[model samples]
Target chain A: MQAILQLLVSGVLLGGVYALGALGLNLIFGVAKVVNFAHGEFLMLGMFAAYWLMTLTGINPYLGAPIIGAAFFLVGLAFYAGLMRFTIYKPELTQVFATLGLSILLQNAALVAWSADYRTIQIMPAGWESIQVLGAYVPTNRLVAFLYAVAILLAVLVFLRSTFIGRAIEAVSQDLVAARLMGIDPDRVFLMTFGLGIAITGVAGGVLMPSFYAFPSVGSFFVLVAFVVVVLGGLGSIAGTILGGLLLGLVETGIGYVAPDLKEATHFVLLILLLAVRPHGLLGVKGAEKETLK
Target chain B: MIEIRDLHAGYGDTEVLQGIDLDVRAGEVVAIVGANGVGKTTLLRTIAGLIAPSRGSITAEGEAIGGLGAHRVVERGIVMVPEGRRLFPRMTVRRNLEIGAYAARARPRLKQSLEEVYALFPILREREDQLGGTLSGGQQQMCAIGRGLMALPSVLMLDEVSLGLAPIAVKRVYEAVRAIRDRGLTLIIVEQNVGQALKVADRAYVIQGGRVVLSGTGRELTNNEDVRRAYLGLTEHA
Candidate 1:
């Protein structure tokens, strides 16, 4: 029973990172209706940025998050303006291919520049400590990261709900034609939304770098987890992603404790079962079929 | 005032509207009536700048607006309610109305426009927080009209406002249309119900095969013998 409790605690902490990772992907997909296959590459790039900044400038990875996030946001904006906008109005297959090409290009670029070495930034400025809660030991860094993720998520939610541009994003997501009728320039909204989505990954990458190693293909693993969370939570639902992240985190950790080898397999099996039983996802909108992909 | 001279437009290979000419003076309600697939909606959509006219000039107050996009046209004070009530389904009635004033040019007058829209359709005020998709057919129609008014447009175009409504709901929508006309805005309505269209319009045009077949004062076209027989279901044709 104590072992089970310990696993649950670790899972919850890990879920925080997953939720943050999925948030940006969900936001971009929800608003733009395009799957950013290169989203994981963005994460990989962000982690590397933080790692290099720390190595060269001796800056803390935590302190470097906003800088990397801002840089990623600009890159995301340029990407949308230069590429995604043109292909968005095209057929679904075209959009998919365009983004996939971008993903391949970015991944290979990172490989050429950084090589295949797994790199980590060791910046413990001393006095780092862990805490014990209900007989489960929690690492100080994971706790801080979890709290930071939660704070950031809440801030994003508030911004999306209260600000004018945020509401415009929501309006565009619902119906682009109707949004245009309301005098919203769909192109501008798309550009900014894409930027915002990428920006979120910058935050996630910075936060997770202290504990996780960075590699050219690192984003692939987390991006797959993000897709699973998105599907489990329901597409275009911010709240759903948060819940899905926590639930999956707990489930995976619990299963890992029972059979460590089956941890990854368990998630895929659950996903398949969920798809077969509830295709709309846990909190998805009704009649929200595959049409959203279009 | 609005004017379209020698307009040509199409979707891909087939030309939907060929050399169409029309005019709508300020404070006038003009009805463009036609059978299904005759390009009535297409004509309104073109005027609202949803589709680019292949060739021709659309002048609003003497400024050519043919090449402008729909949002740009709205910024110029021409707004469309669309054929169907294209309300954002998940949005609240209030948010849907708020989005109507997304044009920065319309920002200063947003409060007055909101009040005017709520006054014109009190039902919307009552259900302001309800999701637009949950509204009844009549209520949704009202919301659609209200949304257009929220733009504070000088010229409002409604496409098929009377479609898919009960007789009583249709009457309510028309009454609102009449009130809109009383406000002295330039109105262009595309309607299938000839009786209602004729009753509300100051001038009327009947379109056939993407061309204007007949046009006159509302009463003149309503009283035309051929129009009565073909469209009004008079006994001579039956």
Candidate 2:
């Protein structure tokens, strides 16, 4: 029973990181209807940024998150303005290829610059790596990442509900034609959404640096995890994302406990089954998936 | 005041509005009536800057705005309540109304405009917290028009206000239109429901094949023999 409880706690903590990683991708996809194939690359860049911030300036990643977030916001703006603007109105294939090309470019660029070295940050001092909760041991870094993820997600929800610009973003996400009639420039909204999405990812990357490795190819792994979370959560639904991540985290941790080698296989198997059974996801609006990709 | 001279516009490769000309003065309820597929919608869409004019001049208060985008057109004081209510279905009524005032021009008067919209559609106020999609068709139309008003438009345009509604709901919308006109805002209404549109319009234009076939006061056109024969589907003096 203690074993099961420990697994559950670990799963929930892990799910928090997954949720944070997927949040930005979900936001970009929800508002802009762009699948953002390069999302993983952005995460990779974020990890590198956090790594360098710590290595060069000796600032803890958690403490340096604001700087990372602000920088990534600008990177996101440049990504949209310099590349996405041209292909935003094109066919879905065009967007897919465009972002895919960007992903490849970024991956290669990181490979050239940082090489294939795997790096990790030891932020917590000696003998303080794990914390006790409910008579179970949990890593301090994972717990901190989990708290940050939940807090940021809640903050995003509040902003969307309360602010004028946030409401405009929601309006555009719902109906572009209606939003235009209401005097919203969809282009501006798209630009802002891209920036905001990437900015969140940067923060997620920074927070996860202590627990995870900072390697160029690491983003590819997390991106797949993010896709699973997003697909399970429901496309374009923030609250659904949290649910999806938590569910996946628990399932993966349970699978890991039973058969460690088959752990990675569970994500694809579950994703395929979920897609077949509930393509709209756990809480996605019906037909939204079709509307966005098509 | 607005003027469209020799407007020519269409979707890619297919011309819809060809050589269309129109003039709408301030404080006039002008109805553009036509059969389905006769370019009535195309004209309004072009005027709203959703469709760029291929070869024409659209002057609003003497400033050319023919190829301006929809957002820019709204800044020029034109707001369109589209064919369908087109409300953000998931958003609350209050959010929908608030979004309508998103234009820079309307943001300053958001409080006043919101109060007026709520005053005009008291049902909207009562259901302010309800999602837009949950409203009945009649109530949706009222909410849509109310949203347009929230933009603080000098010239408000409504496309097919009576598209799908019961007779009582139609009457309610007409009464709202009367009240809006009484408030002294310029309006350009396009309708296939000739009777209701004519009842409320101060001036009327009969469009056929993207051309203005006739123009006169609402009462005059309502009684015109040609208008009766063509649009009203009435047989010439049997």
**Which candidate number maximizes TM-score?**
2
Q: Considering only chain A, what is the TM-score of each predicted structure?
A: 0.95, 0.98
User: Tens-digit lDDT track for model 2 on B78-153?
Assistant: 9899998899999999888989999999999998999999889999999999999999999999999999999999
Clashing pairs in 1: none
Q: Give the poorly placed runs of model 2, Cα more than 4 Å off.
A: A292-294, B236-238
Clashing pairs in 2: none
Write down the TM-score of every candidate.
0.96, 0.98
Model 1, residue A183: displacement in angstroms? 0.5
Model 1 clashes, total count: 0
Interface RMSD score of each model: 1.0, 0.6
Cα deviation at B82, candidate 1, in Å, is: 1.3
